[model samples]
Target: MQGNQLRTFMATEQLSTFNPVTLQLPCGMLRGQRLGDVQRFLGVPFAEPPIGDFRFKAPQALADWTGIREANSFARAAIQSPRPPTLVPDDPGYSEDCLYLNVWAPIAPGPHPVYVWIHGGANMAGTTAQPVFDGTSFARRGVVFVSIAYRLGILGFVDVSGLLGEAYRGSGNNGLRDQIAALEWVKHNIAAVGGDPDRVTLGGESAGGKNVISLLTAPGAQGLFHRAICQSGGGQTYADQLMAEDLAQRVRIHLGGESARADALLEATPEQLLAAQASLVDSYPAKSPFRAVVDGVVLEQAPLASIANGAGRDIPLLLGWNKDEAGFYGASANGDGGVVQQELANMSLSEFDQILIRYPEMFPHLKAEALRFKALTAESYGVPTLRIAEARARIGRPAYVYRFDLPPEQGAFRGLCVHTSELPLVFGNVQLPTAEAIGPVEPAAQRMSGIMHSLWIDFITAQPILSDATTIWPVYELGARQVAILDEELRIKSDPDAGERMAWTTWQPVAAE
Candidate 1:
């Protein structure tokens, strides 16, 4: 089904009632819903919908409502296509007016810890309503969960230039701004729903995790969150701001708008602009290139560079990525296989020779495999993790790194954890209709889930993520780089692949200019 139909079904089937509550938001009365022990407020507008004259502009504060507005179900997801068919069968349709958020808080009184989740889709796709993202588990554990919907694709990241005035000056970071708006909303209204406004933990996987790190360094987002957890992605080596602008210009040219200036591009209809942006999916860099930019205002500098300079010193962080991250890329590239072969073709003769020199033993038998693995790891997990850890160490803040190595046994591609394998385990929602229908939940999965969730909660409440039975999570030092390798049996390892890490550290991109 399309996204709108699925959303309608979810609203009618999953969400059943509306329970009104008064909030101090500019809007006086807001009607939310009560689901089991938690009261969920859906489609609560954090910022005014970015439509009509507001298109491609920074978020504006929501206008006050005279009476209670029913917030029982999710609003539309940001404008983007459904996730690739191989990953998720169902397609959630997209829309332009999609800047809404959902909240799940304990119904009983007293302030509970809040966990704000940002969903992942390479910054181009994804929604807040994935079954794996259900907040019931966290709410049951006495934590409030908030999921946000941010602008995506061109609407969110397009650099329209400052000619449109300051309102549109920061247009490139609208998605990041949307997230800050949601946090701002939580800061003002979560307390009313029995959540501690001061103890918010921002977490996400893939692009969501990347956004988590972006918010960590954003001046506007500094005080909005107390803690952060990043899974699979980080804001270390992001697409350059100029590159992002160039992509925006491509979209403008495709839409028949003037590319020399921002005014002509902003004049196009939202649908026209979105279609132009969507057309580039097939042409986007092999590695996802559209992401949070280093705009000097919202983002003063690259997250990793800023962190290396002692930015975000006060906030604690839990960051990690999975093993076989390249496995998914390999799988996704299976149809054409050229995706992998072409990437292997692009490595410089020196870098290509270096791969042979560094891993002479492993390179001979698996040269092709090594190329694919290296490309995947560098883009998906390696660079992100290294940057995050390096920045955290530079700031002298406590940082714990983890590598998930649990391989899936049933999927077409066996012996690989792939991207998002940790989601079901982290949320304890392995019992979802889809996963259960696939097969019985593995006992190891249960153990892994317990460990992961326990570590997360512990990090939120106490600065450290430790358990009675587990090994101590040592802080990541620049040299030692201690990280927990999570699997059937957990082990504390220092630099699991020192050679690969070292090689990638010095590997610079071919200048995009």
Candidate 2:
């Protein structure tokens, strides 16, 4: 059936009131609510709470339960600096014990393809509870969809390995560990919930996108997911272990006294820890302080290097980035007069340095200010994205590359396809604040949503796209670089970033150093 046709059928076959349905897994019996053809099971913990002495430890397996467990409300999001009420208005609550996942599967007779999504907020913020990530549309399309929550900020990414010892070597990757645990749960138990565990495709956007890349390099994560999708991500690599440990030492000193033991962090209040996290931001003004690092246990190699060496060469990949991802971060730059210079001054060594040095020869048409943002967009999202596809292709793997160019109405965002603009469409979140608060729905956007969702469902289900196509999404080769440009009208473009791509030919990532 067509994606839209399936949705129409689900809409008409809905029962306004329904009873809770139960499914038994090895761990326990879960009671989920039925809405139309989809059954939602929320706040299902795949691992025990990482609290108290276990705060910095790896996730412990959950104890088996005998009775029916109510999977209704969302668990608290990971502890981090709170976002503005506008981003996540519902406020699902926040805490350190936030390793829960939500499942959306059709009430089908047998197993269906599974899509496990990792939520993205730069590894610092975001939760599975966000309304934008609801999996109903995918479920209605006969796919089992799951969204997982992981530890965030200092709690999730900080490297405490050197100071905390062997038991905590993987602390820096706990957020990712939580994701792997969720995937493991899906592999073992999803079949009981009408999901085909072996047919799982793992994906995410932004930080979640980066996590998907990291999982590709993780030895423990091999074969957990059969396919991977990385959208507007795969730029940053894990921090070098020594650099991360130094940062962790500074944080430890800030949280506990100079002579305090590592355990002092355990004794500190949550507010104290948050304050220390803020201090780390102040210390590393140029770079992000809270992120996964090469802690030697979970993440042993850099993501791109591993992929380039064939770690993910066996996996089918769908990788792409947005057109103007750096638009949203332009305001974070200094004043217009010296904005570009100030951005440079704040950075000791970044991809911008290489781009600026070669800017005149590579791209002389764009102004310095515009070029700065453009370079940033390319470096952070575009360039690495192209390189990932190119790397996978170099290793004889199949990868389809595309760029999302559809812009929202000419209003608050000024028609720019800023960061995260494709999310509402990808999630099929028609009721998102962007639609409600940004302005009335543009007819093109509504149509684009259906197209994007259709393409995604096709990839997830391992089915040919629509069965009405003249061409399959072409493999992105080095020079050809054919990209399926997604807009109101689907078009194909070659070398979307000819200038930027050339500029970055010699450009090096900060993490690569």
Candidate 3:
């Protein structure tokens, strides 16, 4: 169905429903709320809560329930140290029992394409309860939108198999396992809520983006979704088994001593775990330690290598990065160049020299230190994204690449399209208060939001997209390498930054090692 026809049908359907919506699924009956053109089911449990005995273990499917469950409110966010700007309003607060997901669907009939979102907070601190993630826009555009929550920090990514033995062999990736289980639930039950089981699109930003890309190589994630959209996160980095174990050891040290047993770490309270996690993060101030572990069981190899060898080769992808992703971290006056320096420190002598030479004048307007920071963004976000697109293109798959260059004219991220700057525009929540921090939501910005939002809706619907009679989004093939540049004006450029791409060949992520 086309966008206009779907909206018209939904408008007609809206005239018939003044009552709450309900669905009788295999598990039980759920009573949801009807919000104008959309029907929303909130705080629906998809898996058994990962708490107490289930802590640090793979998620178990929720058992069938009795009676009609009220699905009107959002569940508690995953346990973590709450960060500003990203926190949910009138916050549902935090908890270990946070495996619930929220859904939004069009009121009109039939199954619509599904869009499942995994939120981004370095895999240690985000929740789907944020207002920016509200699915009203997508539902109005005739799509079923879902946002899921999972365990975070030590509870989510710290590998304890080395200490706890075989039962927790893949425990480090419990967060990812939670995401897979959510997809499984959607695949089996989304049909009841006007979602097409075969046409699901998984998308996310930052840590969430990294998770979706990792899912491309995850054995448990195959056939769960058909398309992917990764925003401002790349597949170049991941925690290998050794790195995962190091995090486990650090947690133990913080809890007791080096001689601490598995029980000492596992039996610790949520407060104790958060304390240890804080210390762990402080120790490694450069980057987030929480990431999917390449354990032999869950993931046999690094994601990029697996993708190169044709893992998820058939899935169409919409991949891109902002003009300055790392700028988000360095936005403050007392900016820590530690993150950029640490990434440079990971490189060899020759690789480090190459970066300094190539990036010192890359962005001529920025000062010396700022230029290096931009280079870090290119190395971390740009290079890996381009590499993944190239891999998919080589395998003859569709990879619609884009580059978001529209910086805010005013506010915290003024003149810099930092990480997550495209979210408000893509999600069509430009007027939200949090969005104002990124930039002013003036008429020009609103127009930009419409252009970016429409592109995403088109990709989810698997329809041909034409921005105008003259401009078309071309596939990122090996030869052409066309990229849609989204700014005040949309421009499709061929290999926009050739020089910067070449400078990144020497350095490689630890995952590659």
Candidate 4:
């Protein structure tokens, strides 16, 4: 197509005042679209397509190209199972060759802090194409926002190193390695788009949040990002080598009975692999089979353990979870039934009894299942979030903890600030169509969005987190246990749930780091 037609197409597609601009970076020249003050470079290949020979392997850096590549449209999302009704895919399709990143930057020049986002889906789903993750608000606030897509499910997290031999040594961590590679690309290329490479903040939610914590312990990921924001993700769920291999064995069996060889994984179609993964996941509904493995090379130690031992101690952290994290699973068909119970089964019987006994005393008004919901919410998210914060506090590092208290005023998730409720608020996309599916905008939502979004921007910009004149966000402390309670009105609370906190003190939820 001619240059004029290309410009017209971008303008029409973006549905905004589009000024086609070309940027020359280390890898290649990219033609991006500019709407008003924000310049967006979508579908930018940070690495070569992880397909064919690179399939199920770590990502490779993109080689230099001679001509300008059109980065106007988003690339296909990573191949995975279908999303629930709440999630809307940003891309038109899904494919194995989905190693791409999107950048939203201000038109102004000079260095700006960067916020690199990694989407979460239990290491099985999600894409950078989601509308809720759009970086326009962040860009308008003078922060360059970049979101990336990595391999998922069996293709990304299944450990085949033990069966396929040494070539795929970090096979289980392929998605993480992809993230590291993207950071490396950012380190060398972000300045061309008015972003400071040294001031990059890595952030994510759910599985993406887990990856942020995982990357904190990854040797290759060191110095790639300077700060992190982990939402509703803890460092307790990683699989050791043996466990990863065991899960891989199950996947192999589902791929093709007992006789299937490891080599056959190379020839199986994406559809067949996804089908087998579905079966494997169904077989173990309670377990997260495919996640980061504690391979000595890629991830030397568990994230929580490493953080406790001063790993990434210099990096400031802003992390938290929603108050009703388990409500999304319970009473909602969004996930498997009994997941809350399955997750809590890891606790000792005595510890379980202690929590069970406290439920009635702590919440006298709640019923049995409602009480269980509160217990699971605290055990699953609150415990781990505080654990990481305590680790940081113990080391005299900066850490800000928060709990999202306000539930959506509309939708099926009304009155429940369930898992992933903060995405639209943090991204300041609460009015977007996809966000509407999550929850409609309420009267106080705009103010809440400003409060949450501004706090994130303050962190990314390394400015003081002044949410409002009266509210002062404090660093987490071992004594005070101060937590920012985010809602229609921002307030600080000390030991919000003292009862639950006291109960979990006798029982350690995760293994020692």
TM-score of each: 0.86, 0.91, 0.92, 0.93
Best model number under TM-score? 4
Residue-level lDDT of model 1, residues 78-112, one tens digit each, is 87766554334445566788888888777788688
Q: Higher lDDT: candidate 2 or 4?
A: 4
Candidate of highest lDDT: 4
Find the 10 residues in a row with the least total lDDT in model 3: 337-346
Candidate 4 residue-wise lDDT, 113-141, digit = tens? 99999998878888787778889999999
Off by over 4 Å in 2: 1-18, 257-260, 337-351, 357-368, 434-441, 465-471, 510-513
Q: Which stretches of candidate 3 lie over 4 Å from their true place?
A: 1-19, 85-87, 331-354, 466-470, 510-513
Full ranking by lDDT: 4, 3, 2, 1
Each model's lDDT comes to 0.73, 0.77, 0.82, 0.83
In terms of lDDT, the poorest run of 10 residues in model 1 is 337-346
Could you tell me which residue pairs clash in candidate 1? 3-92, 3-93
lDDT of 3 by residue, 183-269 (tens): 999999999988999999999998898889999889899999999999977786677777787888888988877788778877888
Model 1 regions lying over 4 Å from their true place: 1-26, 83-93, 162-167, 257-264, 331-367, 435-441, 463-465, 508-513
